[model samples]
Target: MTAFDGIGGAYAENLPVIMISGSPNTNDAGAFHLLHHTLGTHDFKYQIEMARKVTCAAVAIDRASDAPRLIDHAIRSALLASKPAYIEIPTNLAAAPCAPPGPISAVLAPERSDPDSLAAAIDVAVSFLGKKLKPMLLAGSKLRAAKAEKAFLELAEATGYAVAVMPGSKSFFPEQHPQYIGVYWGDVSTKAANNLVDWSDGLLCAGTVFTDYSTVGWTADPKGARIFTADMDHISVTGHDFSRVLLADFLSGLAQKIKYNDATMVEYSRFRPNPTLQPAAEPEAALRRGEVARQVQSTLTPNSTLFVETGDSWFNGVQMDLPDGARFEIEMQWGHIGWSVPSCFGYAVGAPNRKTIVMVGDGSFQVTVQEVSQMVRLHLPILIILMNNHGYTIEVEIHDGAYNNIKNWDYAALIETFNAGEGHGKGYRANNGRELADAIAKAAANTRGPTLIECTLDRDDCSKELMSWGHWVGAANARPAAAI
Candidate 1:
């Protein structure tokens, strides 16, 4: 495959991309002529050489002892560069004698915040927070990656700021928390949600990437307002230029310096849920799907790990009421459509004690349904919930009737076709609310092996909240410059 294709594209999106390549040693290059694609190739650093053009940094390691240091350096370089990095490890060196383990140290520690600079930044943030009628806290994946969830939540609570979690940080905060304003991306972000972002006078962004999807391509501007950004690396007031750069280790230090007051808390306490005013008579099909989501959520155990596929299935699935100990996972960075099924398999293998539940649309499930065979082979007790709406529902919403549909498949029968019917796994189907409840119950009770619950839903029975958001976004985009 060409560079920038396959997983390489992940790096192109300004996200961290690390490539590890196995190559022959420099001295053995002569004998490993066949490994080279072209003749007269003396240097055996093809991978590293090629990677240098595409990656921010590239290095070749000939000794096993240098692998850890090289890897750490590559990762640090990639994060700082905000681009991809590559490392080529010679096959011979991989098996070489290990070096003596030294005292471990953080390769990339947070830069110390200057006392004066820190005071100025905190003063600006505190002044805005104190003055703003409504302030918000937007938590991003960086907080989760840095294990700063408690600090984030504490800050949000202390400031009485309504918290809106970025899509990638779904489980970073408890959804049931009164201060939580719901997900800030995908289908969950409605006009009301956008309004909340619009209404805020100040935004305190903690470890978040204020990217397109998260802000709906800057539709929700934090302009005319102060923006306080805190991360391991840098902070920007308006996110235009770098205002201050701090090492990650200084988050606790920064948090301690900022004082929380009752006035900030008072404004946040006044925040209320702005639910969509639905019609008295909801469509029969929409009602059915809602009930199905409700049923599945109710049946899930506290320790369940839910993996939601990208699309309408994800939109509907996250609306479900998750239990206290339940955790959710999705490929937010890549937004890969078929990630759920295979990712669920990996999660099941990695976490054997927890029950892994995968919620996927029929369209996305077909992408990597073959992994179900592997699941059966491993006897991993995973549950797959197929929302069989018979098409790519989200795409249809974005581009109505524009070849977004897909051919139907016998979703439940696929499990039987794989012979995972009894001891290994079982398959079940549901069409309505009652049937969905039964199917989910059966799947939960089947402790021996994996289970596939295919819920046949009407393609028209999509999420109203999602539809409204899409319509608003489209309308906003279509409006003329001055009018908007």
Candidate 2:
């Protein structure tokens, strides 16, 4: 039940996760015995039936002979949908004998688009690409789920248009790329990003998702007829649907059919990094949000993996550029606070060889702080840089009210209580820029166990971009009543 409750976001994002569980014995399933986990019912299919609502496929392995085929079907369905799949092995059949696995093949074969439909969509898209004076590429987070990241990047390289990622796709593409602009979320976008995208005569959005939060509460500019969209199951141009297409195949085909141009390269060059803009002298007294962000960026290594929490951290963390070979994860569509803490625990377990760093806010950290004990128990090298702003800073920025305030916790001290005064783990509190830098360095060097660094900041100090985004979203949330 707990797992089911947390799976909807993964399903909506089309993330692939396989869940296997042990079920009641098939013999007892229909007998007088009432299971400990199930609702009082003779039918054992209720749990699986409920799971089917969220998962792409669900199956109960009642017979040993049927396990192989059923498991294969669930895996293939999950891959095809890029969503989760559930499999249950009855306790009586837990040791079921199955044939050895077969050689690897295309489990979910690529479904080709109709030739005429594909050609027409591509022609319309190509016409827009070639004729338009300003064309832009907006990549979405689904490109990562579809395993089409490389193909999408190739497409961006081939078509020399400025590329911007959606808010949900902050780290999907390399931010420091030559043609990369910034995130494009309509009104929530940076001045340069919104301007370029709004002025674009043609837009190519691949694997894009547009929700109220991502679109500034549904106040984003509507797409015109010059937009090309490709998803996992569909490809379309100007609302003309091209069915049964795969994103990777569509990108490959489009790459071959188009003549590459670099008209937008001039605009892209204007957004390139300017070293002179960086602060010449570090603030030795007070620690600001921007300074904390810069410090986090300075500590990142090529092998480090970063998880940014949902809050003002989104705006600050997105400012950091990912180094080569580093991995980044953020939950934008779900936007659930405190998810990173536990998720980073799982990440540490999966990749023990690499260091895992988490950027979490004080309010959100309170929700999932217990996960830190698991890291300490396993001696995982997880560095938690906590932003102690005394309340839900994101909410205060969005809709300032008395309800948004929270009781402050001595976050760094709690680490000692969790650790039970053991020197196996460490905790540090930093209230100023110099102390914050020292704490970061100490945490980086301490690899024996998980270390927690609580950096205190003014409650009102948040990234300017977050404030800008919050204002727009707040206004949208409280829009004037519509006429009947």
Candidate 3:
């Protein structure tokens, strides 16, 4: 009950999770026997109702014979919707006999992609591109979620157009691809990358959610460009909308017909890395935010995975290169603070064989600090680089509000405190760049258990990209009311 509110968006955004809950027996209903976890009402549907808001489907398994069908329906709905589902099994039915699940492909309903819609969408996109002098592909995270990464890459290669990724979809597309440009986050984007994208004559965005965060508060000026966008179920090209078109089907069709735009690729300098601007002073001269980013970048390896918190980490992590096979996870759409802590915990468990690293801020860390104990208990060797920026620096950068200032905690001591003399984990506090580097090296070598390295930084330490994004988003959030 206490954690229900936290997963609303998680379910809505199609996060695949199964929550099996135990409830009172259906026979016990209307007996006036109050259940301990109930809402003190005769009706037992209260909890189910609460869960229905977030989950795609909720089922109560009342009969043992019907259990398999109900379970199958719940699972199918969850997969199709890409969301969470609820299944309530009474304590009495816990040992119920059910039909065995045969082949999974036969159990789930087939997802049909309309042939007409797919072909039309592809034709429209191809025609739109053929008329433009410059066309590019803006890829998003949904490409990975919808299992269309291969199709998307094929389309990019087939079209021969320059490719860019939205901030939210970072690492979904291979950054090392020859035609790959850089992240396109509007005003917060790298100057060359943003210009190439915004100035394009045609833009085909696939599996993208153009939320405020991705567009830098809707300041991206791609309206002038002919737009063709595709998601899981629908594709919109210019003004025409095609329904019942799956993202993979559309991309696959586009890949078959997308004309080569070699001229555009040549003009944009394809295969070249984004231009890097040198800082005036050496990175070690002062303990600056950019230097911190550089250190984090240097720490990444081909086998490592990075889980960045929803704040300055987004900007800093973006600047780091993701070697092939390396994964980067961030909650951009939800933008929930402290999400990366538990998220990293789950990630570590799911990918136990891979090296995991989490970059979290002091304020965000406080919200999900308890998860560290579980990581230690499970012996997950994740390196936690906690940024000690005093408070919510991202919020301060956006709106200098007093509420953004939060109470700071002794973050590094938490590992030992949670360990409780168990020696299950290690912790360290670093106040300077040298100390930070040393602590990182220690974390890299320590494989005994999870490690926490608290890096003390200036209160205002933030990336330039964050400052620009914050300003734009702040302005949008503070829109004038009723035109005054």
Candidate 4:
């Protein structure tokens, strides 16, 4: 089912989402006729069986009386695991008479780490830090799910170590912070980030994840430094593994136990220069990816939330210089291409106080372009930077073929077609730097509805990093049979 990818995304990203579905009633057993959407088979449990693979918890509510308890269990499991849950209610059971729901009293938070494990993890981490002359911190994306970002920042401040956030964890720590270095992605690391991380004798890689894409085709090297990992549900330092030690608790405890160590920062300052992202571009020159990044960075405000589609947009977004309060949303794990349109719309609905700026490529935009109409109908103030590249550039970089090309659309005019001139949503096409600046200014002033700016670019125009990354990924995928 289409919902399967979303559920998988939630699981991989560690979001607590609950999905409810309707099924044939218990009395309709073997009738396949009872439900039109049933897989048209006698196996009634097939749906839940498939869902169980991607969800943290899956439950079937066979009776009206059991709904409350079953639902509570599902919710609690999903919350504790920071993953998705599925609840299926039969048709007859759903229609059955039940007592009216009561207002929820305060819900309880998940349990803290095991006391023994927590104490041991902190002691080991403290001991490890005491032995090292030069140590550094590496932040990862999993900190969001662990609710450990504040603690991670506290640890970074309490111990004056230079920090390099893994590529996937960009913006986890305030990028503008004094101690923050850059995004570390092995060979593609920013400025001196990889050097600093590799040179350290001790490393604390908190909440980090390493997949082929994140590691750039598995070329990332931690070097010979001893790694102390405060993973989601456990802490692993050297050879010791402390189970049931939550990341938040371990970080909080480590912050309390450690004092400032200026060795790493002293060395970092001796390096060439501070990291710079997306250097300034000429406003009069033809538009390029760097120019797009530069313009996007200029548009970010403290109240803005940037959404990056899963394509070259991801690499472009990495160049943004986020303000202290700016939020960056990217579905990097289970990267379904068209996820941004719907997701950006949903985020606008949830956080109306914040402005949404989404960068999506033409190939990906076509997949879920219909969601923009919902924005117009709701009068949501959002800015969509559509890159009309005429094809799947990310795919072309990986392995070019006829299927990589897409039919080009007049993307800027789509807003008028969606509204038929009824709604206030506006659209503009940007061919160069001047057009982009004008479009952005107009978008900033438009609050009645969403504004879309389509920036036309060549199909082959993409980040050089993307091309290099794709080559490695292609090689990894095309290894000889004997290598395995």
The residue-by-residue lDDT of candidate 1 on 344-458, one tens digit each, is 8877888899989888888888888888988887888788888888788766765677477888988787787776344467888876665666677787787767899888888
Candidate 4 residue lDDT tens string, 391-481:
8888888789999888988888999988777898999998888889999999999999999999988777898878887888777777789
Which lDDT tens digits does candidate 2 get at residues 393-432?
8898789999888899988888777777664677898877
Instruction: Please list the C-alpha lDDT of all candidates, in the order they appear.
Output: 0.67, 0.79, 0.81, 0.86
Task: Please name the candidate that would achieve the greatest TM-score relative to the true structure.
Answer: 4
Best by lDDT: 4
Q: In candidate 1, which residue pairs clash? A: 110-247, 110-248, 111-247
Candidate 4 or 3, higher TM-score = 4
Q: What does candidate 3's lDDT look like per residue over 15-53, in tens digits? A: 767778899986779676777888888888788889898
The regions of model 4 sitting more than 4 angstroms off are 30-34, 95-107, 223-225, 272-285, 482-484
- Per-residue error at 376 for model 1, in Å? 2.3
Model 1 C-alpha lDDT versus the unseen true structure:
0.67
* lDDT of residue 241 for candidate 2: 77
Which residue pairs in candidate 4 collide? none
